[model samples]
Target: MALGRNISPGQGAKYYRKDDYYIEKEGGEEHKLEWGGKLARDLGLQGKVDAETWEKALQGHFPGGVEIQGGSMVDPKTGERCHRAGTDFEFSAPKSVSIQALVFGDERLLQAHKEAAAEAMAFLEEQVGARRGHAGKTWETTGQALTAYSRSCWTPILPHDGQ
Candidate 1:
C-alpha cells in the first residue's frame, strides 16, 4: 500500500523541512504569507514568523498603516502623504528662526530707538524750557548794554585814557 502525504504539517516538521514554519503554525494563505514576510523583513521586525503577527506588529509600529493599504504617495518635504507597505522615507528636520536675528535685526529695534530719541528730546526740553519768540535778540541786546556800561566805568581808571 502507498503512504499518504502530510499536506498541512506542524511547525517542527515545517522547520525541519526548511519551509515556512510560522506560516504553517498560523495557517496563513500562501500569497499573504509571501508578501507579509517580505514587508516584515524589510521593516526589520523581529519575531514576525507569520502573517498575523507581522500585520499586528506593523499596525503597532505605524498607526496609519491602514490608510496606505495598497500604497501611498507622500511629499518628501511635508511628510504628508500615503505610504505603501515597506516604503521607507527619509526623515526631515523642522525649520526654525534664529532668536538673535529676530530680536536684534527686526523692526522692533527701530521702534525702540525712535522712542529713546523722543525721550531724550523731551528731557532736554524740560531742562532748557521751550524757546519763546525773539529770545535770541533780547539776550544779545542785554549782553551788549552790559559790555558798554562796564567799558565807560573803567575808562577813567586807565592812565593813557586820563592823559
Candidate 2:
C-alpha cells in the first residue's frame, strides 16, 4: 500500500491519514501513532528506512530530474505539427506587412533575422524618435539610426507622418 505520514490538523493534514504512516518525525513534530485500532505491525508495514534511503528511492520515480516534459503529453499517433504566430513579417519591403516570418538555423536565415530586427527598430524610431535627455553612458543601434536620447540636444529628428 502507498502509505504516508499522519500530519497534524491544518498542517498538511489533507495529504496524511492515521492509517498510512510512512515516514518518521517531520517539522519538529513526530507523526501521531495509535495502537490496537491501527499500528505499524497491524498494517504489515513495520519496515524502517532512513531519510537518505527514502530520498534515493523517491528519485527513482522521476525521470530527467523534477521537470515534467510538456511535449511528452502529446499523443505520438495523432499529433503531427506545432504552430507559431507573429505580428508582422520583416526583412522585406511590403506596404502594411502582416504575416508570419518563420526562421530556421541557417546563415541566410540569421542574416534575415538581423535585417528584420533592424527594420522593426527603424519603424519604432519613426513612431517615437529619440529625444534629448541626460546620461553619462548611452546606447546606439548597429546602423547610424535608433540612437539613445541622452546628453545636450536641440530638436527631434522626426520622421514623416506616414504608416
Candidate 3:
C-alpha cells in the first residue's frame, strides 16, 4: 500500500538527512536518493537531496523570478504569499512480501519493491500540480518527489505477522 502526507517548511531535511527508519546493513546503514519528475531535472537537482536545494524547491523558488522570504514565496503576479511546501509519498510493501524478503535474505526482492515504488511514484508525478490563481487555475509540476527505500524494524513483532 501507498500513503502520503505534506512536508512543511524546514521539515524537508528530515526525509533526506534522517535514516532512522530504514533498513540496516553490514558495517553500516545506507539510503539512496533519487529525484523524480521533469522539473527536478530542469532544476539540475541530481545525485542527493541537499537541504538548501530542498528548501528552495519547497518554497517554489524557481529561476523564473520567484521570491522567497520568511519561509514563504511571494506571488509575482498578485503579491500574495504562498506557504505550501512538498508532499511525502510513502510506498510500502505488503507484510507477507516484507517478511519473505527478510526471512529469505533476498536483496533482489527488496530491490524489486524499490523499483516498483519508483514506477508508481513516476505515475503519481504526472498527476501532481500547483495551483496558480484564485479562479482554480493549476499547472503541472514535477512534484519534486524524492524516492528512497525505508524499512522499520524497531517493533518487537511485525504488525502484519498476526501475533
Q: For residue 111, what is the lDDT in candidate 3?
A: 79
lDDT of 1 by residue, 39-158 (tens): 333454334245454444333332234321332445344566633222221111122222332335545544544355344433433342222356473321111000000100011122
Model 1 segments more than 4 A misplaced: 1-48, 60-81, 88-163
The collision pairs in model 3 are none
Question: Considering summed lDDT, which 10 consecutive residues are worst modelled in model 2?
Answer: 146-155
Candidate 2 lDDT over 109-163, as tens digits, reads: 4455446555564554444322234474444322222111111111124443221
On TM-score, the stronger of 1 and 3 is 3
Query: What TM-score does structure 3 among the candidates reach?
Result: 0.59
Sliding window of 10 residues with minimal summed lDDT for model 3: 154-163
Q: Please identify model 3 stretches exceeding 4 Å from their true place.
A: 19-31, 61-82, 136-163
For every model shown, what is its TM-score relative to the native structure?
Answer: 0.17, 0.18, 0.59
**Which prediction has more favorable lDDT, 1 or 3?**
3
Q: Estimate every model's Cα lDDT from 0 to 1.
A: 0.29, 0.28, 0.54
In candidate 2, stretches whose alpha carbon ends up further than 4 angstroms from where it belongs are 1-105, 129-163
Give me candidate 2's TM-score against the actual structure: 0.18
In candidate 3, position 113 carries an lDDT of 83
Best by TM-score: 3
Question: Which prediction has more favorable TM-score, 1 or 2?
Answer: 2
